[model samples]
Every structure is written in C-alpha cells, then in structure tokens.
Target: MKFKDYYQALGLERGASEADIKKAYRKLAHQYHPDVSKDPQGEEKFKALAEAYATLKDPEKRAAYDNLGQRSSGEQFTPPPDWQQRYKTDAAGFDDVDLADIFAAFSQAGGRQRQDMPRPGQDYEIAAWVTLEQIFRGGEIEVGAELPEYDQNGLPHRVAHVFKITIPNGAADGQRLRLAGQGGHGVNGGRAGDLYVVLAVQPHPLYRVSGRDLYLDLPLAPWEAVLGGNIEIPTLAGPVALNIKPGTLAGQKLRLAKRGLGNRDGSTGALYAVVRIDVPNQVSPREQVLYEQLAANSTFQPRAHFATGAGA
Candidate 1:
C-alpha cells in the first residue's frame, strides 16, 4: 500500500488556504482536460487532479489523510488484520465517496469477485523514497513493488513488479507519480487498477522539509552571532557565501530566496537558515583568563529582564 498526497495533485501547498485550493483546481482542470490539452496523458492527469481535489476539498477527509503522515511510499505495506475495523466509514449520508473510503474498501475486499458483474482491480498506493537532492535534480528511480494479480474469480496473487519511475524536478513530498495499468490485475477482462507511487523525500541530514521549502540549522560561534560576517552556506546545487548581519540572534532565520525546492511553474522555494549559537565546553587556562576578564569588563546584562518584575 502507498499513500496519496492530495495537496501535490492540485499543485498546492499543504498549508494552502481553501481559496487557493479552489483556484488551483480550476486552473488544472482546464489545462489538463483531454479536450483542452494535447498532452499525451491529459485525461489521466485530469482524473488524478479531480481525485486529489475531492479528498482535499472535504475537511473530514483531509483530516483523516493527515493522520497517516510520512509513511514510506513506492514500497509494499501490509495493513493490519483489523485495518478495516479501525477505519470504518463515519460519513453519514454523504453522497460522494472520498478516496480514503475507496482505499479501505479495497483492503477489505482484497479483489474479491462480486456477483456476476466484471470489476476492475482496485487502485493501489506505494511510497517511493527520494532525497531532497534527487528532487532538485530530476531523475529516475527503480523500486521493487509487490503487485497483485487477480484470478478469474478475483482472488489476488502477488507478483514482484520492478518499477522505474521518473521523478519530476522540484517535486514536493506529497506529489504522486501515477503508473497506469500497473496495479492489481483486472478480473474477467476488466481494466487493471492504476498504481500511484507517492513520492516521499527521505529526511536529509542537513535540511528539513516543509512543503517545498527547506530549512537548515546553521551553527555559529557565540562571537560570530554577536559580530557576524560573510560565511559559506551549502545549497542543493553548490556552496555560496551568505552575509550574516551583525547582531544576529540565535533562532533567528535568514531567508535565501528561491534556493529551496523547485516547482512545476519554474519557481523555487526559499531556504531558511536558522541560527544556532555554539559555546566551547572547555577552554585552556589562557582562554579562561581572557573570558573572565571580558565578563568583568562587559556590562551586557542578559538577565536584566529577569531582574525586572515585569514577568513576575
């Protein structure tokens, strides 16, 4: 099982306002509709956009989706025996079925043949892990996935499927790469379900991701934070010099515009460098004497606020 990122499908941020979601859906719907676009996969993209929007537009569905956070995509995930019982339908009298419901139903049915009607194989989601650098530089990924093949009566048998997926440059964490007709096999000549490989960027050693933006902790010496200067900073592409303003405080964030993740619209997200002041744990005799002398000479009272009765 793989997870789907509804926010990515609509090309919107996770924190995108409701108005933003609506605006993005309208634009994508028009651009990707098979009738309006010449893109080879226009119809497929359109369907996915609709599905993503449907899940996100509903607050109840969105909340449920968020609960399953950061699970590895593009890999096999076996649901618990009582998965269905845990996620029973709570929506009452809702005319439309959300994506979460569809996923739960598929897990319970396990591709069982129902009555005499031909049924298509259930759609599946797999998590695919990629690095922030990989998203910065678009490339292909090959992952091993266990695809289920259904028998004539809709009994599912597992098959090992090797997938080579092309990742889009600047792809966000919740974006999905759709692989058509690669999911569970069709039963009674019905069409095979689509496979959605949701892109999950692994946590980077240097950067933390929030939507498309990247955040990095920049450790600076206490002196450096107090008297800042030009410092070298690492980016996805290469290293660049950053001007650290004088009197920068710890925990203060400095923004590097358009230096983070890439987007489909040719825009990139900003990178935030958060200041972290480092202090030497130990010092030589000479250094200790110098520090003592400086402390005695310095009148900078850090505890002045505590001394005042304002907080108390």
Candidate 2:
C-alpha cells in the first residue's frame, strides 16, 4: 500500500503539539473549504486535509499511525508485522485498501469508547430573501437546505431538510434569525446545531428603504406645486392624504412621521415623499394662451444669478 504522510499534509512535524494541529487544520480548512474556495483542486485538497487532521487530532489514531514509522509520501510500503498483529487484521490481499481506510479500522478497534462519546453537530447559515411588506409585518418564509446526518457507523450523509422560519416585525436587512437545534443532527447524546437565517430585503417597485425609513416619489402638477393643497399619496398601509406646501421645489422631501417600517421596540420610522413636478405632454390652445399670458406678466427670474456669472 502507498503510505500517506499526515504530518506532511498538515505542514507539521511529528512532535507538533495538539494545539498546533488544531490551529493548522482550521487555517487550511477555511482556505480550502469547497463552498468558499476558488482553487481548482480545493475539494480534493480539502478532503486530504480533513483526513489528515481527523487521524492526527485523536491520540489513539495518531499513535497507530506513528507506529507505522516514517516514509516518503506516496511511497509503497508494507505494515510492520507487529502493528498488524496488534490490530488483529490479516494484511493478506489488502493491497487495494487505502491508508485512510486502514486508520478507520484501527480507530474502530481501539477507539470504541471515544466513538460513543457525545459530539455536537455543525451549525449552518442560509440566506433568505424577504419582501419589504413582510418586514413591515411579521411573517413566515420557507427555506430548503441539505444537512448532515450521521449513520450507525459514524459516517455522515447529507439529508434534505425544509424549514419554515418566522421573520419578526422590524427585522432589519442582513439580520440573522437563529433557530435552535435545527441544523446538522448530533451524534451520540449531543445537542443538535443551530440554523441561522440571514435576511436580505428584496428590491421594491415603489419604495427605497434605508434603515427603517421609506422614500417614495411623489409626482405633482405645476398648479398643485404652486397652489399647495392636500394630495393623496400611496403608503404600504393604504392611501393617505399629504399636505403639500406652496412653492414646493423638486427634490424636496416631505416627512410623514411613524408611517414607515415598524420596530421591534414599538417604535416606527418616518416616510419621506420626494417631490417631482410633472408637466402635461400636450396643452390645448387656450392653455397655451394662458401660459403665454402668465409668462409675459410674471416677474420671476429663476436664472437671475446666471446673469451675474457668479454660478456660471
């Protein structure tokens, strides 16, 4: 069988401490984890690293591996007669057995007590897209994911799971809602892991949100902008009357208190109506004549500062 050098795979020496082994595994695992890595061989490298760490992290497995003596990585070698007799395994016709499998058998034989010990499962995080309306009011959303489940032999397998998560009122964008004991299943008598649902607010057709504030574009005619009157504006709740001040300019914001998103602390955000003056596409002859009369009679100089070249 070809021998694998677990210490070499982890870039550690035979005499390295347990803390060093854990630290090295964590660093390499983060870099090569299949979900986040961009390397072409990341999956293969990650599996190798995991296998190496799995054996080295355990005292009994490490002792069994160390008994095999030092050999160059991938070099063909035979296990010592004493090592085979200790494990009570006949090495005859076992050439195809991988080095990892050999350690698995060794662990099964020597680490039965360790295997029965409780071990907590891994936690998982999933992103969920929520609508603005849902954020305004508490609601439920469904999400599906694959979680790990350990079999009778202590082998992990992926199992599909569906969960309905409750989104609380005033749940902010990017907030994580944790569901206790909903992640990977635990082994032995350990507790299951938690599932974190991360919220991502979907883009709205009529409103833009910042914190809890809502901004909506309010279009008004020239006369309405100049005359100042009550106008109906649409909110998430329904249409509400908004008072427009006379001579309101474009790009001005009119605030409506407590009309935005609700907060968990029983507070509410403000809604701003952004003013936009709109003109008719076509005007009648009488309207054109009236416009002409107003233009000739009005003394308004909107571009008066341009004449002084001060803002040119």
Candidate 3:
C-alpha cells in the first residue's frame, strides 16, 4: 500500500495540539463523509481519512509515522531500524484504548508483531437542518448517504450508494444522531460500521428561539396600536389573532401560552410576540387632509425624550 501523509491530508501542522488534530479531523470528516458530502472523491477521501485517523489517533504510531518521511512512499512500509524499540512501548496518559489495535496493520505487514488485522469500518457524518414545526412534531428526514465499497483486505475501492435518514423532533442545532452498521464495509468478516447525522437548524425569519421560548417580531398597523384590536400573529403552528390592548406602543411584548418549544423537563415555554407598528405608504388625499386636521388637536410628541439627551 502507498503511504499517505496523514498530517498534510488532515491539514494539520506537525506541532499541532491534540485538540487541534481533533478539530481538524471533525471538519475534514464532515467534508468527506459519504452521507452528507457530494464531493466526487468523498469516498476515497473518507477512506484516506479513516486510515489517517487510525494512525494519528494512536499517539505511539503517530510519533512513528511522523518520523517515517520519504521512506514511507515505497510500495511496502519497512520501518527504519529501532522502530519497534522506539514505539513498541505502551502509551502513557491514554486510557480506554489499546495501542496494539492501531499498530496491528503495520505488524501484519511485517513491521513488528505478527497479528491478524481487523480494520474497523469507517464512520460517517451528515449535516441536516430542521424547521420549528418539524422540531416540535418530530418526523423522519430523508437524506442521501453514500458509502464506499471495500476490497477483500478492507481498503476502499471508491464506490458508494445513497441512503436516507429519519430525524426525531426537538433536535437542536449542532446535534449528532448516529445510525449503526451504516459505514464502510468491514474486512475479514468484521462487522459493518455506523453513520452520523449532524443537525443544522436554519433560523426562522420572524421567530428567535431561546431554549424553549420563541420570540417573534409582530408588525402592527398604527391604528391597531392606537385603537387596540385583534391582529393576526404568526406562530409555529399557524396564524392566530392576538388581542392588542388600546394605546399599545412599539417594542411591547405579548406572551402566548403553549406556543413555545417543548422542553426536556416536561414543560413547554411561552412565545413572546413583540409589537412594531408599521406606517402606511401613499395615504389617500382625504385621509391625508384629515391627519393634518387631527395634528392640530394632538399634543403627543413621540420624540419628546430626544432633546433630554441632545446636549448631554
């Protein structure tokens, strides 16, 4: 097998921190994973990513591979002298992982230990967005996922297929949902892998969701604000008329019951509809003359407070 430069492929510096490596991997994985990505070489790139991760995720093997340099590009990977003595030691500070699993491939290729290598099926990621209604109702979202074909030895042949997904309700943005046994094919009778769906909720044009409560910008007519009447307000469910008290002003908020998002603690939040009176364009000649006559009787000044701060 031809050796790949894991760091370059991952867009990382040799001196990159572990957190940096993890962040880079997450980004590249999202870009190359077959399910969400339509890149022509997504499958190929994903497999290469899996291979690179399999190496970089292991601190010992990563240290060794980082030192390999040009010697790795040859058909077979023959480690330089003292490679085993150099990296054969178990890693410190790494818990819950076995170093043997990562280096087994190299060993099977005659680097160190002669153990059978069973590569893990690759993992996949997808990004999805949901509407507030969908978030409340919870339903299946069909997405196209393509997985690469694998060789007998478990390396990828760069072939894939599209698959769908069913998303649940109340899913927040940046959430990841996993589908088991849906990743790259396994090798040597190993088990198939898994797929992940990443959530990306698009912002609503009128409503801003905070936790379970939703805030809406409700446009009201000037007469509606001044005279108080039932005005149609938009909600996640649909449009409903809300009673606006007489002499209502801009920037006032009305709280509606049972209209916010569902919370995890078995309670729902209230939706706040903020009021903003809109002025009419091109008034009728008679109405314009009436307004001019009404101005003489009206002593109200909306910007009376402006002069208080004018000289300060």
Model 2 steric clash pairs: none
What digit string (tens of lDDT, one per residue) describes model 3 on residues 1-312?
Answer: 244567777887777778888888899999999788999589688867766777888786787677766432323454455533344422221122222233434444334443445657667676666776777776777666555553343223333455565555446777788888887655546677788887777888778988788999888887789999877888878888889999998999899988888765657788999888898888999989988988988998878778786632
| Residue pairs clashing, model 3 | 138-169, 145-163
TM-score of 3: 0.60
The Cα error of candidate 2 at residue 21, in Å, is 19
> Roughly what TM-score does model 1 have, to 2 decimal places?
0.60
RMSD of candidate 1 to the true fold?
A: 15.5
Candidates in order have lDDT scores of: 0.73, 0.82, 0.68
lDDT for position 108 in model 3: 43
lDDT (Cα) of model 3 = 0.68
lDDT of 1 by residue, 1-312 (tens): 445677878877778887898899999988998679988578678878887787677665566566656453343343333333443432221222233444423433443446445557668877788888888999888978776554333334466788998887668887887889887665457788899988877879999988778899999987788888999999998998999888899899999999998888888899999999989999999999999999999998877778675652
Return whichever of 1 and 2 wins on lDDT.
2
